[model samples]
Target: MRDPLTVSGPEGPSFWAEHAWLGTHVEPGVVLDTGADGRITAVRTGVAAPPPGAVPLRGLTVPGLANAHSHAFHRALRGTVQTGAGTFWTWREVMYRVAARLTPDTYHALARAAYAEMALAGITAVGEFHYLHHGPDGTPYADPNAMGEALIEAARDAGIRITLLDTVYLHGGLTADGHQPLEGPQIRFGDGSADAWYERWTRLRERADGDRVTVGAAVHSVRAFAERDGYAAFAERTDGVPVHVHLSEQPAENEACLAVHGVTPAALLDRHGFWKPTTTAVHATHLTDDDIRILGASGAGVCMCPTTERDLADGIGPAAALQRAGSPLSLGSDSHAVIDLLEEARAMELDERLRTRTRGHWTAAALLRAASEDGHTALGRPGAGSLEPGAPADFTTVALDTVRTAGPVPGLAAEAVVFAATAADVRDVVVCGRTVVGGGVHRTVPDPAGELARAIAAVTT
Candidate 1:
């Protein structure tokens, strides 16, 4: 796959949208000009129509959606895992079975297809929460970072930006007794200790391009690290890079943490100086009041994967409270039961409404920000997710004439998109001034659905 950054000419490209969301409201006849470096150089509104050389984009265009947290391999388990009665813990056993079957080559095929699907859903950037390091049975490949490299290459082939959040997972599971040893397929995820993990991460960072591919670090969860002191040391070593951790996704996890450490997961991490501006906590479903206060005061971000949470029967999170307390919110398609960022955005608001028996906890614009701007920020792309000067030349157009998206007032285009639209409504996608998907079809991946079926069959069957 060719890099979109190098494919543009010196003059770059310009796009004219029939209607565009400018972060706050909808505007008609907007023209966005990009520089050769793939950043927006200028944005003009009130243009009557497409200029002679500008590419014409019909329907409603918005900044590209960001999938702030992802497990690319999980895309294979989508329909296969839905048939059984199970919790997140039970689902893990099945997921591990698939993980044991993957090689660098197979993983590349699967992730490439998965990422192409993300492109079709208007996701321009994905933060891959990757921990599947080494080969099966706890052996390192010729290249220890081979699995991570496969994911980076997959993103390139799929023509989307990626933040490879390489994860450090030391232990298999935490119990009231203590942290357990990594056994079976879980051994592939462990790097022996934080020092070794950091050493590998340092090498991975050296290969990161910092533009389309940013390398980040992650702690698998509070249970993954044994000692509290290790959190502070890991935080210091990974300073400045985006760090993410799974936090209290289940009540069982919180119960075990309190039993072993005598504090909630959030409080335990906060006591060790792990919460920082660069850190983001995923799930955050079972947080206490003090946990919320601690996370909010520390300025860490929260990434909510609404579809996965609902799929796993996790309860609604206090998203509005967290935002009010000063934590930025972002959305992700974790587990990928569905890959629609629009649905993820609306699900967060709708789930909140279901919890409180109230409506309009968040406006459509605010939800869109969670899906785009805040999500990009969480993935270390702060200037992306907006169609403005100096932002990345990434945007997607949703067909206003789609069956579900029709009949909305022009001013309420953002609302219509967030509430009514699905991934099928995405008509075009541009990333780094290159159109990856046009007319609801992917440019490079020829047949994403066929590729996905083949890749998933290779692993699941």
Candidate 2:
């Protein structure tokens, strides 16, 4: 039979150790004791072994990774959206039509499968940029938080942590000029006023049992929050929580913002107190110098979705510039075009090389930190993404002995990880000291492809 502990079937934590590494490299005596609340009570990093009875986890210990941004609904559209012509705009027309028909049942099935895949790939947490809010035709449900509950329950079933970045999407575009109305499924998301959306934002429940989920907030964009009241109200409400927004994701958004407010979306967010360390700017392609300055000055985080960016033909983001300006960088599997974390990291650096006149613009260490540490920090989980004392025993172990990464010392394993590792080599994944992935597989009931098929049948047929 398989190892009893292999599938991580809700069994409690025990003792763990091995070649553990955090922001830096691995050290022995790295025994981690996980608490009932999922906090780290003690970390002894000497040659000491667990006293008395013990459980030994003999692999590299590192912080669990956070997918800083995701749109779970889009996971269904992955290969289907690949062959589409036209630009992001044309694809979005098709997306909106699909979004118009989803019920909570469909979202739960789809998200559970997507989150399980994230676990298989060693992503312990995700900040879901969710905005599809109402019934099939943009009408409010009997319970306003029904859609939110579906997402939360999905995370629980997948055995992963989530920060549901509940969103506020108001208008379709600038002053209703050439901008289309909240057409198709857009009506389900709006609350009539930004203040009204703020009221719902405040209703978010911030705690999760077993330390697995949390609620957060997001502003869809400058286009979604056209009114001065809408943006200001949102920022003020989400002051201390994890906040995210789609800022400067597209040049058209910038042009529209300039046409209406005479500023880029980043500048407009700054004016509205939306820029903060707790904030994550998604995509963040097409930045001006001032845009970089504001992002750096605010100390917000950036999530570069290389797969989605390349898939949609969005311009490359200024990752190196954002780093130089003091913004902590992170990665996302936005639109679920690809859920592999290392690919996101590698594509980020490679895209920089493709766009600029320089080579070696970003270090492998930086990419690794962005993948594991920065994202956890940005996710507001203390001591996350590290193997030090007081950090959650959340981690993934990869075999460096593979042919793809045999060229470098294990000291450079993190770099090799970004450059050479694929999801296939991720041998184990742990969340809160609970083994979730073993035999290089995550145990989940719903089939991912089947779930995608169901979603397609619901929306397209």
TM-score for all predictions? 0.99, 0.90
Candidate 1 per-residue lDDT, tens place, 317-413, comes to: 9898999888999999999999999999999999999999999999999999999999999999888899899999999999999899899988989
lDDT of 2 by residue, 1-461 (tens): 23211224333365555556656565654666666545556776775666555455554545677898899888777777777477998889778877876788888878878888888788888888989888866677787878888888777677678888888888776642534467667888787777777666666563443246667788887778765555676677777778888888888888888887778888888887778899989888999999999999999999888899888988899999999998999999998888988889888889999889667977777777888888876666645777655676677776566777556765676677778987666767777766777656666534656765776577667
lDDT of 2 at 445: 35
TM-score of 1: 0.99
- CA shift of 223, model 2, Å: 0.8
Return the top candidate by lDDT. Answer: 1
List pairs with backbone clashes in candidate 1: none
Q: Distance from true position, residue 190, model 1, in Å?
A: 0.7
Instruction: Spell out the clash pairs found in candidate 2.
Output: 63-385, 138-188
What candidate 1 gets wrong by more than 4 Å, as runs, is: none
CA lDDT of 244 in candidate 2? 84
Model-by-model lDDT, in order?
Answer: 0.92, 0.76
